[model samples]
Target: MRAIVVERTGGPEVLAPADRADPVPGPGEVVIDVAAAGVNFIDIYHRSGHYKMPLPFTPGIEAAGTVTAVGPDVTGLSAGDLVASSDVRGAYAERAVIDADRAVPVPAALSAEDAAAAMLQGMTAHYLTHSTYAVQPGDTVLVHAAAGGMGLLLTQYVKLLGGRVIGTVSTPDKERLAREAGADEIVGYAGCAAAVRELTGGEGVPVVYDGVGKATFEDSLAALRRRGTLALYGAASGPVPPFDPARLAPSGSLFLTRPTLVHHIATREELTTRATDVLTRIARGELRLHIGRRYRLADARTAHEDLAGRRTTGKLLLLP
Candidate 1:
């Protein structure tokens, strides 16, 4: 099997291609012949050492593929099954092994590319709208990075739940994309809070979904209505600095939470429920995925370069 390994975490240049013996399934595990791997910000964290992993590890955490081998003690799945999963490392390869319990069946209506693209980001958006803040009809919410992969999906899901979205983007092209995804108001980072205030008639929104941490944290706090929540999910712009909890009191008595997909999908049932909900919505044409770019397996370095440079939009993928 050919896989990209990071012997040392530093830059995208460290992702090197190498040949290794095919992975063998362990008890309660399944070996997948990876059809597509989803390139995400988490992968960048791993490669850059922001998220530490054991040395000489493969970086990806999400992918969709066909099961070629099923290990002992695994039930309700078999060879030749199509599956997709998040929170599994080693996805940046032609083959990878994962626990059977962590893999979910991919509906026939979705292609391999779509399944891989939708798993991590789709599930993240799912829990954000339905669990963390529970968006309601007539509720206005703010979403940062509104033109990126997660942003687009978050925008669509908020609309599906009957909420209006105020999206923040970095460019004119992104503003158009955010609007297409159902955002009611689109603004750049320079005046995002003022724009949100204007859109809400100075009342602000009920919740602010912020993934671009550090850079937008203060603005996110200012964009919320009294008693609103701030769901800080990611740090694409970089991790946020430590701060005093006392600040929340003056910011409209806002609620603040930092949620991760791993925590939300901790149980097998929860994982399946969220994954199923997102995938079924896609199958029914209620939600859509935008795959911005595709790269060959060996071009993993370039993929990371573009992602870290913020040179691409939507979901980026690697076809093995």
Candidate 2:
């Protein structure tokens, strides 16, 4: 099997193409012939050592493909099953293994590319809106990086739940994309908090969905109504520095939370439920996934470069 191996953590240059023996299914696991792998910030974190991993490991965690073998103790799944998972091990390769319980059945209407693109970001958007800070009808919420993969999903999901979205974008193209995804109003990074205040008639929004971390942390707090929640999910520009909790008191007694997808899908039932909801919506044409670009498996370095530089919009996929 050909995979992107990281022998050391430093930069995207550390992601090297290498040949390895084919992965075999372990107990309670299934090996799939990977069709596509999702490129994400977490992969960048692993490559740059921001998130530690054992040396000489494959770099991806989400993919969709066809199951070719099942391990002992695994039932209800078999060869030829089309599955996708956000917890697959060594997903940046031609083949990967995942525990049966973590693999979600991809609906017949979705392609392998779409399934791979939707799992991690789709599920993340799901938990952020539905669990972290549930958006209520007539609620106006703020979404940062509203044209990126997670941003587009967050925008649409908020609209689906009957809320209006005020999105922040860096470029005209991104602003157009955000509006296409149902953003009610758009604002630039500069003076976004003031824009939010003026748009809401000085009331601000009920919640702010922030994935751009340090770059927008304080402003996200300022763009909220009194006692509103700030769901800080990702740090695309960089992680936010530690601050006093007392700061929240002056910021209208705001609530700040940093949530991850792992905690939301801690149980198999929760995992399947969330995955199914997102996939089914896609199948029914209610949710839309925007795949900005597809790179060959060996070009993983360029993919990371583009993503980390914020030069790409929508979901990125690696075709293996």
The C-alpha lDDT values of all candidates are 0.93, 0.96
Full-model lDDT, candidate 2? 0.96
- Kindly list the per-residue Cα lDDT of model 2 for residues 173-259, writing each as its tens digit: 999999999999999998899999999999999899999999899899999999999999999989999889999898899899999
Q: What TM-score does model 2 achieve against the real structure? A: 0.99
lDDT of 1 by residue, 201-238 (tens): 99999899999999999999998899999999999889
Best by lDDT: 2
lDDT of 1 at 175: 89
- Model 1 clash tally, residue pairs: 0
